[model samples]
Every structure is written in C-alpha cells, then in structure tokens.
Target: MLLRNVLLLLLCLVAATPRSWADDGYRLWLKYDKLPNAAERQAYAQGMQFVAGSGATPVLRAASAELQRGLSGLLGQPVPVVAAAGSRTGGVVLRVDAQANAGGQPLKPEGYRIVKEKNNLVITGRTDRAVLYGAFALLRQVQTRQPLVGLNLSSNPRINFRLLNHWDNPNGTVERGYAGSSIWQWYELPERLDPRYTDYARANASIGINGVVVNNVNASARYLSAEYIGKVAAVAGVLRPYGQRVYLSVMWAAPKVIGGLNTADPLDPAVKQWWTAKSDELYKAIPDFGGFLVKANSEGEPGPQDYGRNHADGANMLAQSLGRHEGVVMWRAFVYKANSNGDRFKEAYEEFQPLDGKFDPKVLVQVKNGPIDFQAREPFHPLFGAMPRTPLVLEVQLTQEYLGFATHLVYLAPLIKECLEADTYAKGSGSTVAKIVDGSLDKHELSAIAGVANIGSDRNWTGHPVGQANWYAFGRLAWDHTLSADVIAQEWTKMTLTTEPAAVRTLVNLLDQSRSIYVRYTVPLGLHHIMGESIHYGPQPWLAKAGRPDWTAVYYHKADSIGLGFDRTKGGSNALALYRPEVQQEWGNAQTCPLSYLLWFHHLPWTQRLSTGRTLWNELATRYYTGADSVLWMQSQWAAAKPALDPALYADVAARLQTQRKEALWWRDACVLYFQTFAKQPIPAPFAPPTRSLADVKQLVQLYQLK
Candidate 1:
C-alpha cells in the first residue's frame, strides 16, 4: 500500500508538470519551427533583421506582422518591425509599385517580385495584398530551406480569382465534410469571434487565395436575413486584414422565404428589387463583400426554372443586383435531371451550351472540371473551350467525397493537373482548359477557379493530416497552373512534413503516385461513378437501384455478359460530339483511344485485347490486385519517413494507411467479384480470385449502409 501511494504521488507530480506535445497540425504548413541548420538560420536572420512597410494599410500591417512572426520563429529570435528601410544594412522592405518588373517581366495586379536591392531584399508589387504574398513567399523559402542568397523570384496568379467554396450550413454540419463540424460556428459568430478565423485567413493569404464562399450552394434563406448578415460581416472583418474577401452562396427562394414575396422568379421585378435591396444591405454591412455563388435549377433547388426561365435569366438577375458592388456572380453548371432517359453526362452540356453568349458580363458559368461530378478520373469538361464568349470558372472538389474520404491518402494535384492540361482543340492544337480558365484564350478580363474546400473544425483542419496537402496544392495550382505536380508535392512535403532530402523525395513519390494508386484500386481505366449510393464510400458496382436512375452505380459501368464500359461515342450516347471535332477524333475511336480512357468512350468485349497486350478481363483484374497491393508500398514509404516526421503526425498517417489498405482490398475484391459474374472468366493466372463471393460483398455494402 505504501509503494502504491508513492507511485500515485509520482504520477500526480508528472501530470502537474508542464509539457509540450508534438505538432497537432493546427499551424498547418505555417508551423515556422526553428531552423535546424545553424548556417541557414544565421543567414536568414541577417537578411530579416527588421521589416519595413506601411503600417496604415491593413494588408501591409498583416504582411509586416507575418514577416516578424515567421522570422522570429524560424531564427529563434524576435525580429523587429521598423517604419522605414532607411540605412538598414540587411533587412526586408515592402513596396507597392504598379509597374514593378522582375527579370524584365511585368507583374500582374496580384503578382509579387522579390529581388535583392542593395544589401536588403525588396518585395514589391502593384498592391498591398501582393506585398503580403511576397512576404509569405520569402517565409516559404525559409521554411522549405531554400537558399536565400541573391534571391530573385516573381510569381503571378494565372487565374484572376482564387476562391474556396465551403459547403457548410448554419447549423454547423458540413455536407460531404470528412473532418469534424463546420468551422464557421454560426451559433457563436457576430458576438464572439474565434481566433481560428484569423489563422484560417493567414493560411489562405500565404497561398494567394483571395476569396471564400462561407456557405453551401444549397443555401438557406436565413443567411440573407439581417441577423445573419451581421454574423457574416463579423467573419468578413476577421478575414479582411489578410487580403481575403467573403462571398455568399444564396438560396434562390430567399425573396419568397425571407422577404415574404409572392414569387421568387428572377424575371419578376419584385424579386429583382428584393435582391438589389439585399445586395445593397450586404454591402452596407460588409463593404468589400464578394458576390453570390448560385446553384439554380439544379438538384431540386428552387430556381428560375420553377418560373419557366433559363439559367442565363437567373444569373443575369443576380449580376444586376450586384450593381456598383465589386463582385461577380458564379452560376454553377452542375445540373442534371432526376428522370432523364438520356445520358447524364450529356445533360449539363446540352442545357448550358446553347446559352453560351447570353449571360451577363459579370456572370461566370462555374463548370466542374468534369462533365459529371468530381469522379476519380474524368475527361475535361466539354464546355471548357466550347463557349468562347462566356467566361468559365473551373470548379474542382478538394473534398474526397468519392476518393475514400479521410481514410485514404490520395494526393489530388495530379488529378487536377490532368484536367488543366487537357487539349480542348477549340482554337486548334494549342487550346487547353488552363487557357480557357485563365481568360487568356477568350481575352476576357475576369477569370476565376474554385476548389470545394475539405477544411473543417478538426485540429488538423482536414480530417486526414495529409489531406492538408490537397488544400495547399489547390491554392498553389490556382495561383500558377504551370507548376508541376511533383514540384508542389516536394514543396508541401518540405514545409509540412520534413526538409530532409531523402524523406522529401520519398514523400513526393508517394504523393505523385497516390491518386493513380487510388484510381487503379477503386475505379481503374476510366471507369467512373461506381461508388456507393448517397454516401459514396466503397465499391458498389452492382447497385442498380436508387432514388434516381443516374444515381445508381450500374447506370455508369454498364457491365454485362457482352462487355463493360460506358459508350459516349456515336454508337452510344454521342456525348463525344459535345467536344470539338479534333477532341472527338482523339477520343472517339476505341481502337486508337488511350487505354486510360478506353472504358469511358467505348464498351469492349471481355476477350478483346488492349494496348497493354492483356485481355480486358485480365487487365481489369490485374489493376484491381496491383492497386490494392500498392497500399502496402505506401505504408512502407510512410514508415521510412517516420524518423523525419513528427511522431504524432507520422502515427496518424500510419494508422490511416492501414485503414486505406483494408478498404483498398475491399474495393478490389468487391469490384473484381461483381464484374467477374458478367465476364464469366476465371481470375487470370498468377493472380488469385477474391476470397469473398459476390453475395458476401453485397452484404458488406448493406453493412456500410447500416452504419
């Protein structure tokens, strides 16, 4: 008893003593841990002795504060902020020069230039916001352990508006969010501001993201009311200092629901007047509010279609409502019918393609990267280069709604880059989705790109710690589409995980191959939309029933005794015709089509030979088996990286990788077994058949649904 009491006293003393846990990922890539290299730390500290910039401007103040904070943390010493660069031997200076040039190249409005001016490094740009970005760039260099001597760097955002579309509701639940509750904290906003809001802004500003839509597209009318407008204004106030603007996703029925109007029709003058008044009221509350993101006439959301009007009519009304406010309306083109007999892939193109030049100048038709929803691998949306007159906002989802949620480590930069680099051939061979999205091809002044955010109230922001890489990758790519996926992966690995070369290379290789690894295991060879119904968790290739025909998995794969794959060519849905003739020619013929997209455009027999020299059946089974096995490789690579990574972060990913391997096996077994029933073939030699029968897999699906 005396020994137990002594032990208890020791444990109590241990608990009372102060101790610091390893990184919980709350700081994200901006951890700013003290530099381990003594030489580099001394060099950076000498170069950043003090920060000189305008303290009057909010953005400049933010830049100066961030420079001081970052440099202090990195150098293990406090850095001073001074009023002027005046005679400082080695320091950082921030200047706003509209005609600033770096390496004889002109800087865009939001672009920044960092060059050595005398003994000090000068970060100059056209606007205060750009100066802030330049400051972050300098800190990124230090964080990534890049050489700081004779630094010369210039970067311009290819897209005019880089935004995050949050699908959070007022009640604090995030739709399709794998992380915890919504970050907005609607119940406490307006009266109490979370310090997290500032950190969120800081993270966004570091990556050149300038705007955020605070609500879901399936919006609630309550957000438009005066009570909620105050709440939004409070949130905007927190973000404004970091050069970020707040936007709203408005419910089309707000006038009827909140304004007590008889009709919510866009063409109706009362509805128009109500919107104008509301817009003006919003501007009054938050002077720099970004405009509305509308999901009209899609997915049972009340829209102008309810009043016999088109998408253009609805979008134009909202644009007019903005009036003198410096904002633009982004109308989503992710529309399809519940009871349509035609190909769902062709529906959005058919509905919006005809009204190409009809939209208002301030209207941007927000098109998903793919024709369908954010599938694992989709051909670039046909509407990208088709509508020359209408500016398009390319929307991609960062949330892994269908890509194994938070359990799988699927790096999405490659998936996003694939769509951006696709040749549309709209204006000949040079036309690409990137060109269309940046407004260079159409020569339009306004352009934007949005990523459906995966952020939440979780300590790590995204549910999976590595999921932070996707958010970082989206912002980096949105700023400069020319950056390679490997480069972004390496940069992120260094900033967020480690600076060791071998560890960085291993992490980069893992990230570079992760998306494809997921694609092969889950939905290989261009197969799309075969995930579980509603929840979209695991494989359900046999799903033939749902609320709507298009929602069913079988509606996409079309696997039968004769063949498997969706046919979008002339002999089938003819969706390929939606693209330019050049693109159609490239993807139209099954015999010459790339194997990656072979199943997307044609249905081929199981016995047919592929370009890879394997029968379709054999190739399918091989991909399933090999993809599942790749998870083990990912686990091993991650294990190799543990020594260089934070213990908490490393263990977090290792546990998730185990979950990924199990699910990958589930996907492989379920898909292989289900498809085997149609192929009527044995698992090829050198590969074993799944231990679970088709019925057993179906039972698994039911079990998931029960959860």
Candidate 2:
C-alpha cells in the first residue's frame, strides 16, 4: 500500500511537469523561432517596429496580421499593425498602387518591390495580393537571418497561374497519397471549418501559390452538387484572405450523373445549359472561384470522346459556361488507349497537337512535364513547343507516385529544372520549355504551372518530413523559374532546418544529390515505368501480365537475352519523329545521346561501351551498387546536421534515412538480380553480386504485391 501510494505520487509529479514541444513540422518553414543572435534580432526589430498598412482589404489585413505574428515570434516582441506610416520612423510601410514601379521599372499586377526608404523600408506593390507576397518575402529574409538594412527585393511570378492539384476524394482517401488521410473533412466542412484549412492557406500564400484545385482530376460528380458547393465555398472563404482562389476538378459526365440530363455531349443544348447553370451557381457560392481542371477521355473517365467529340469541344464548352467569370478550363492532355500498338510517348502529341488552335482562349492545355507519366527522369514533353497556338499549363507530380511513394528521399527540384531548362528549339536554338509554359515563346497572355500536391492530414503536411521541401521548392520555382536547384535547397535548409553554415552546406548537398541517387538505384539509364503493378512501390521489371499491355513492366523495358530498353528510333516506333530535328539528332543515336537517356531511345547491345568507358552491363551494375551505397553518405550528411537542427526533426529524418538506406539496398539487389537473367553476366568486379537469387527477388515482389 505504501509503494502504490509512492507510485501515484510520482505519476502526479510527472504529469505536472511541463513537456517540451516536439517539432512535428506542422509549422513548416514558418517556425519563426526567436532569433538566436541578439544583435541580429535587435536589428530586425528596429527595422520592423510596426507594420503600417490599410487593414480595409482582406488580403491587406492578412498581410498585416502575418507581419505582426511573424515579427512577434521572430523578435520576441509584439509588433502592432498601424493604420498609416505618417511621421513613423524605423518601421515597415506598405503601399498599393495599380501602376506601381519598382526602381523605375514597370511592375506586373502581382509584382512587389521592397526597398529601403530613409530609416524605414517600404514594401510597395501594384495590388493587395502583391503586398502580401512582399510581406512573406520580408519574413523569409528575417527567417534566413539576413540583415534588414539596404534590403531591395522585387519579384513577380513567372507563370500566371500557380496551382496545387489535390488528388483527394470526398470520402477522405487520397489517391496515391502516402501521408495520413485527406485533410478535407468533407462531411463536416460547409458548417465546421478546420483550423488546419486556414494554416494550409497561410503556407500556400507564403510560397506564392495563388490557386488550388481541391479535388481529384479523376473527378467525382458530387462536388458539383449544391450541398458540396457550399462546402467548397467554406474552404474558399478561408483561402480568400490569403489571396488563394479555390478550383474544382469537374467530371465530364456531371450533367448526366448529377443534373439528370439524357446526354452529356458538349454540343448538346440541354447539356450546355445544365453546365452553364451549375457554373453560375458555383460562382455565386464562391465569388473568386478559380475554375475547372478536367481529365476527360482519359483512363476510362467519361468525356466528350464518348459522345464522338474531341478535347477542344469539351474544353471550349466549359470555357463558354464560365463566360465572363474570370475563370479557365485546364483540359488534360494525358490521354491514351488500352491498345499498346503504338508508343505511348506519341499518343498525347498526336491527339492534341492537331487541335491546338481549336481550344477557346480561356482554355489551357494542361500537359504533364513528360509525355509519359511522371518518371524519375523524362525528356520535356514535345507538346511544350508543338502547340504554339495554345497556352499550356506545365503539370508536374510533387507526390512520389511513380518515384518511391513517401519512403524515398528524392528532391524533385532537379527533375523540374531539367525539364524547364530543356531546349525545346521551337522557334530557334534558345527556345526552352520554361519559355513555352511561361508564355514568353509564343507570346500568349495566359500561362500556368501545376504541382500535384504531396500534402495530406499528416502533422507535417507531407508524410516524410523532408517531403515538405518539395512543396516549398515547387512554389519557389513557380514564382521564378530562373532560380537554381541548389539555391532553393539552401534557402529551404536555412529556413526549415538550420542556420548554421556548416549544417546548411551539408543539407543542401544531400538534397541536391538525392534525386540523382534515387534515379540511379531505381530506374538507372532512363529505364521508366518498371515499378510494381498497380501499387508502384518496389522494383518489378519482370511484370508481364496486367489489365493493359502498357501497364506491364516488360512492355516498357523490353528486356531479352540480346539486350534491354525500348527502341523508339526510325527503325522501331519512330516516336523520335515527334520531337524536333535537333532533339531527334541529339537523342536518336546511341553514341551521341546523353548516357542518362541512352536506353530510353535506343536498344543497344549489352557489350556496347558507353561514353563513361564502361560496357552497358558493367555501367548498369555499377550504378545499382554505388547508388545503394550512396544512401550511407546521405545518412552521414544528415547526421552532421543534428547539432544545429531541432532535435525532434533531426531524429525524424535520421530514422527515415535508415529506412531509405534499407530500401535502396532492396532496390539495388532486386533490379540487379532480376536483370542478370537478361544480361547473362556476373556482377561487375569490385562490386559483389547480390547474395539473394532472382527467385528471392521474385518472392519479395510477390510479398510486396500482397501488401
């Protein structure tokens, strides 16, 4: 009885003690932890004594509130938002003018200028939303521990529409989502707004993402119903203050599914009227509704094609429905057939290129970065330069659907930059994919870019804590495509993880090299779409039987006793013809082709020596071996970051690195052992063969499939 009483007392004492908070990454890069350097804090506090701005507009109020909150947290002192900057000294001032100029340079509608004026800084912009972006930029500098003195920053989004496409279903399951359940509590939404929704909006606003498509592209008709429109409006209300407009992915057959129409053809008068009324109802519910992202005639989703109509007919109909609503129709060009008679790479180009000028002015052809699905690496889609008459939205996958789900630590900035920097050679030598998507090459007004959201209900937003960087990178690059991958990595590292120079250097290197490492171990030498059937988790190069021929792994790699890789040259599928003559010349031949993409366009002999001076088999084995081993190097780099990082966050990444190393080995052994059957050669010298036989790897595949 005495011992039990002592234990109860001890429990009481433990409960009374204040628990230290763990960094669960919920705050993301906006941690705003108090400045470590007192001198630095004082300098920032002196420059930001108070925020002077009009709190009349919702976006202005949001900017003021953010400044106050961020300054209070960063400086350990309250920074009030004042009505005006009259006679104020050593404080930040905000000004909005529709035709504002930054240092004698004309500013875009959403452009911002932050320059030192006398003893204070003035953040002037052409619009309230631009001022909000300037506010975030100021906070970013403070968070990165940069001096406020002599600060001059001016920026504008390179692309007009930067959006996050959420592949979330109404029932809470996110398609290909690795984090926890969907963040949208659909059943409780219209009446009960989750505070997380507002936080999500703040995060997006801080990163300059102005639009969000809240539903899956493989859409549901229920989102168009009156009750669901109310729920969507609730979300929009939360995002409006942050200058984010909400969009929905509409089902092509919504008229028939929800509006009781006999035929849902784009040309049908009744169907058109039904869509027009529904769009009007949506605009009435949400004033700044961003419009629709449609996945029509693709992957069995009902589309105008079912009614003997084309993509232009469907997209133009939606654009007409929007009328003068200041909205757009983003028609997906990711269509393909089940029949595998032709190269999947040529399908989208063939189908969409011909009808380029047919799309309405308000319609943007949303093309994936690659012609195929989002592989680890892919040539820039031919459609980027092919369709000069149309405005194209460059869609990239931030969620690691085909890459390693949430388990692998892959930084996507390199992949995005590679595609962006790819010379399309559309008009001449200097034309790039970035120029095409940003409306500079064709000189079109409407342009957009989208990243398939990696976010979910996880406390960190993204499942893996490091996955947050990808979201951050996407936003930064979307705002300004010229920023290098390393620059973005360093910025993210300093803000999210540590300010220590040594740790920052180490983390940046890790992030910069991560994507290449992932590509090496998983799909080296441009081997694409060979992941496990349906789940896409692990290596399954031997995947032969699937519902569709193209769905099978063997259909892509074409491995045999002679050699490996798909033949897309003139002698094979002639898919190279889809690209320009320069691109075809660059990638068509085995000798001149970049080694990274050699296997993608050619089917060479196993004994063929690459530019790396290694035979094909030896190079493949070397990459598999070294790539798996590089995970240890990443672990070491992350370990060196512990002293400067949040303990909880450091430990979280360390644990994930361990998982990554184990999986890397799994990928290495599985691919090498399985491919050995085709190469019919032993593992290269200095790198030992995988002890596990091909049968063992096959068993692993079977086990993963069961999961």
Query: How close is each model in CA RMSD to the real structure?
Result: 5.7, 5.6
lDDT of each: 0.91, 0.90
Query: What residue runs in model 2 are displaced by over 4 Å at the alpha carbon?
Result: 1-19
Provide the clash count, candidate 1. 0
Scored by Cα lDDT, where does model 2 land? 0.90
Instruction: Please write out the lDDT profile of model 1 over residues 108-184, one tens digit for every residue.
Output: 88899998888898999999999999999999998888887878999988999999999999999999999999999
Please report, as a residue range, the 10-residue window in candidate 1 with the lowest summed lDDT: 10-19
Residue 99 lDDT (model 1): 88
Q: Per-residue lDDT of 355-462 in model 2, one digit per residue for the tens?
A: 989999999999999988999999889898999999999999999998788888899999999999999889989899999999999999999999999999999999
Residue 580 miss distance in model 1 (angstroms): 1.3
